[model samples]
Target: MTPPRLTPVAERAVLVEFGTVVDAAVHAAVLALDRALGADPVPGQVEVVPAMVNLLVVFDPLVTDHAAVRAALASRLADLVPEAGQGAVHEVPVCYDGAFGRDLAAVAAQAGCSVEAVIAAHLAGEYHVAMYGFAPGYAYLTGVPEPIRLPRKPAPVRGVPAGSVIIAAGQCLVTTLTMPTGWWVIGRSPTPILTGDPARPFLFAVGDRVRFRRVGVDALAGTQSGALPAPGGA
Candidate 1:
C-alpha cells in the first residue's frame, strides 16, 4: 500500500494520517513506523507523537527546512515493514467499589446491564495502548467492548484522582494525574502510572497491550504486591 497522505501541522510539525477512524491495523502501523523512524530519524527531527490515526513528527526548522523533513518522512513510509503482533502485555488491577467507581450505576443502567456486568465487560477484553496523550503517561486504550463504550459525561468531572479507569467514545483510558475528564469513571487503578524515575515514567507505552483484572477493595494494597504474575514475561 502507498499509505495515505500527509498534512502539515505547523512549521515544525506535520501529521501523517493513516485513516479517518481508529483501527488496530492502522494503530500498529503507526507504532511500527514510529519505531523505525526513531531508529534512523530524519535529520533535525525532535520527536514523534502517535495518535489514534496520525503520526506527528516534530522537527527543528533551524537545523533543516520543512520540505526536507517531509520528504524524508515520505521516503521512510514507502519502505515501511509490517509490525509483528508483539508488544508487552500488562495486567492492570482495578478496584470497582462504590467510592472509586461512583458512576458505575449510571453506566450500567445505560448499557441495560447490572453494575457487575459492566465491570465484567471492561475486564474481559485485551486493550491495547493506542497512544499516550491527553496527559503524561495517560494511555488511550483500544478494544473496549461495545456494551461499555459509554460516552463522556455531559458535565466533565473536576479533579478525577490519579489512577482513574475511565471509558469514553469506545475506548478505555487511565489517568496518571488528578485531572478533569469527561469519560465515565468506572474504576480506579492501584498502579501509579507516573513514577519519579524518568527512565520508567510510565507503566504503559504505545503499542503495549493491557488487560484489566477485576479485584476487590483489598486488592488495592497489592499495587506493589507484585503478587500478580507478570504478563508475557514482563
Candidate 2:
C-alpha cells in the first residue's frame, strides 16, 4: 500500500489523502486507515471522518501538536494491514412501478433500452456506500453500471419523495427526505434507512456494500418495519 500524504488542516486536524481519484482501491485504503485509527488512536485524537479518497483526523490541540500527530500517524501507517471486505452488506428491496419510477422511461430512452432492461441493469450493480452527505440519511453509493449511467438533470426536480432511489454520474442514492434532486428516480425502497434514534441515525456507513432487489408495488406495503432487513447473500 502507498503511504497517504498528510496535510495539516487548520490547527486541529490532518487530512490523510490516499489519492486524487475515486478508485475503489483508494477508498479501501481510506477505510483501512480509518479502522486503524479508530482501533488504536494516536495521542489526543478525537475523531476521524472517512471520505472517498481521504479522511480527516481531528486531534485535541491542547494535547498534541501537528508534528506529534504526524509522527503517530506515520508509525501507525507502517504497521497498517489492508482489511478485506471490511463493512456490512445490505440487500435493499426497491419498487420500480408507478410514481416510484417516474423517470424510468426517460432513463430507458436515454440508455436506448427498455424500462425493464434499465431496471435489470441497475439491479445487476453491486454498489458501495462511498459517503453520506446532502441530508441526514442520504447515502452516496458508487459502482453504478455503465449502461444505466446518466448525468444529473440540468435543474433540480421539486418535491421528490423520500425513499426514492436515484442515480446519476455513476452513483446511486436513496432520498432520505422529501427534497429536490437532479438525479433520475428509477425506483423507491420501502426500508427505513433513517432511524430516529440518535444512537444509530443512519442505515449505512462509508464502505458498506449495497445490492438492490426488485419487488412489486404490493410487496412494498407493510415492509417499512423501522429497520433494514438483515444482511444476506446477493
Which regions of candidate 2 fall more than 4 Å away from where they truly are?
197-199, 222-234
Q: Cα lDDT of model 2 overall? A: 0.86
Q: In candidate 1, which residue pairs get closer than 3 Å at backbone N, Cα or C atoms, i.e. clash?
A: none
- Write candidate 2's Cα lDDT for 145-180 as tens digits: 999999999999987777889999789998888788
- Single out the weakest 10-residue window by summed lDDT for candidate 2: 225-234
Compose the digit string of candidate 1's lDDT tens values, residues 33-130. 88888789999999999888889999898898778877998888888885855779999889888668878899999999999999989889788888
Q: Report every candidate's CA lDDT.
A: 0.80, 0.86
Candidate 1 residue 47 Cα shift, in angstroms, is 0.4
Q: Please, what is the TM-score per model?
A: 0.89, 0.89
Which candidate comes out best when scored by lDDT?
2
